[model samples]
Target chain A: MAKIRPVGDRVVVKPAAKEEVTKSGIVIPDTAKEKPQEGTVVAVGSGRLLDNGERAALEVREGDRVLFAKYSGTEFKLDGEEYLVLKESDILAVLS
Target chain B: MAKIRPVGDRVVVKPAAKEEVTKSGIVIPDTAKEKPQEGTVVAVGSGRLLDNGERAALEVREGDRVLFAKYSGTEFKLDGEEYLVLKESDILAVLS
Candidate 1:
């Protein structure tokens, strides 16, 4: 698999698949599922360049499970696997 | 007029009106005109908070004519005047 190194505070995440089961055990179709906003950080960029020429450290690290904003990030496929590249700010929280 | 103080690297801008004239002097109607991407800064936030707890100085200041990304920012009206509030990153360049 090719390694992806995001640039400038961007992160590459592999989103978790949306759950297809309902509370009553009904299987929802793919079209009815919402896009997953949760993902695991696969890679992180160095940091965002600050106005003072310093790089702001990223709060999330690789292997961290994170929740990002809905409809954020660019999606792409690498080696038949899907990934998303988004800025650190797009990530709302790091799941414990 | 009520004063608006934007918060957290956000800026309030009064957008320039879109041009209605073509090169050949044809007038475009309001419905056909694209949204203007240029504006004058009316207010600015202190700055974006950095990971180190320092605020990053914004490049655009109040009264600066700037170009910003289209479809960015929230639109609001104050005292019947229209304005846009957008983050500094949404501003593309400062007009000289």
Candidate 2:
């Protein structure tokens, strides 16, 4: 598999699979489902450069489960697998 | 007039009025006009906080003519005047 190194505070995520059924036992059609907001961190870029010329450290590391904002990030496919690239700030929280 | 202080690397811009006529002598109606992408900087927030607890300095200052990304920023009205608030990063270039 090809390795992807995101640029500048960007992160690559492997999105969690979308749920097909609702909590009320209703089956939702594929087109009606919302994009998944949760994912596992696959790769992260070095933190954004500060004015003082130092690179800030990112809080999330590889393999961390994270929640990101809905409708954020760019989607792409690599080696038949899908991934998303977005800024670290767009990641709202890391799941325990 | 009420003063607006943008927060955290956000800038307030007074957008240039939309042009009604094209250089080719064609007139465009209000409904056909694109949002203005040029503006003057009116207010700027203190720079974003770096990891080291220092604030980065913004490149655009008050009164600078600038071009920003279209469809970016939040629009609001104060005292009947319109303004836009967006991150400094959204500002593409400072006009000479």
Candidate 3:
């Protein structure tokens, strides 16, 4: 259960896996690879309001798998769970 | 001199100081502290275009200290220089 839903076109993302084990199942180090680009959408905001007196609808719906920049969004904790609040535009693509 | 000026409204930020030595001049470990919230605006992209025939103005200009989400930028290296390109709206506030 979500404690909060994004209020204004912001999305909460659960980061994707960041570990990769070798064929021998040895874990790789963080410095050797780039961060993950995928995430699971946990919460979505109501969309940002424009100066023109209109609110834009989000292209990506909640529960969608998405591609985003590795360093975007505001990170915070909800009930001890970490989540990201990203603007709808920050979402790069909705995965198939 | 800057290698690139942000185009539009995406501002590039240099991460602020992340370490503080104690009164004894001993360095503090990263695990003991939260990340920095301040950054210097290096490059800015032209503001994101609105659906209407308009481009919103950026509130913060280059060389300004700004507050932004730690997780809200697409990190990339240009000519071996690290930078963050952020939408003008992503900027939380311009520090005085």
Ranking by lDDT: 2, 1, 3
lDDT of 2 by residue, B1-96 (tens): 138888888999987775612221222223322322667889999888887778876667898766565679999998898999989877644544
Model 1 lDDT per residue over B6-52, tens place: 88889898977656112212222233222225677899898888877
Rank order (by TM-score, best first): 2, 1, 3
Model 2 TM: 0.45
What are the per-residue Cα lDDT tens digits for candidate 3 across A1-96?
Answer: 344445446677876564511322334356745443677787665566687636677778877877776677665443445556677777887766
Comparison by DockQ, 1 against 3, better one: 3
Which number leads on DockQ? 3
Q: Summing lDDT over every window of 10 consecutive residues in candidate 1 chain A, give the lowest-scoring window.
A: A20-29
Residue B50 miss distance in model 2 (angstroms): 0.4
All candidates: DockQ: 0.02, 0.03, 0.04
lDDT of 2 by residue, A1-96 (tens): 125555457777887765622322333345644533777898876667676746698889999877787578655544456666678998987877
Model 1: runs farther than 4 Å from truth?
A: A1-48, A51-96, B19-36
DockQ of 2: 0.03
Candidate 2 — number of clashing residue pairs?
0
What TM-score does each of the candidates earn? Answer: 0.44, 0.45, 0.43
Chain A fold similarity by TM-score, each prediction: 0.77, 0.79, 0.70
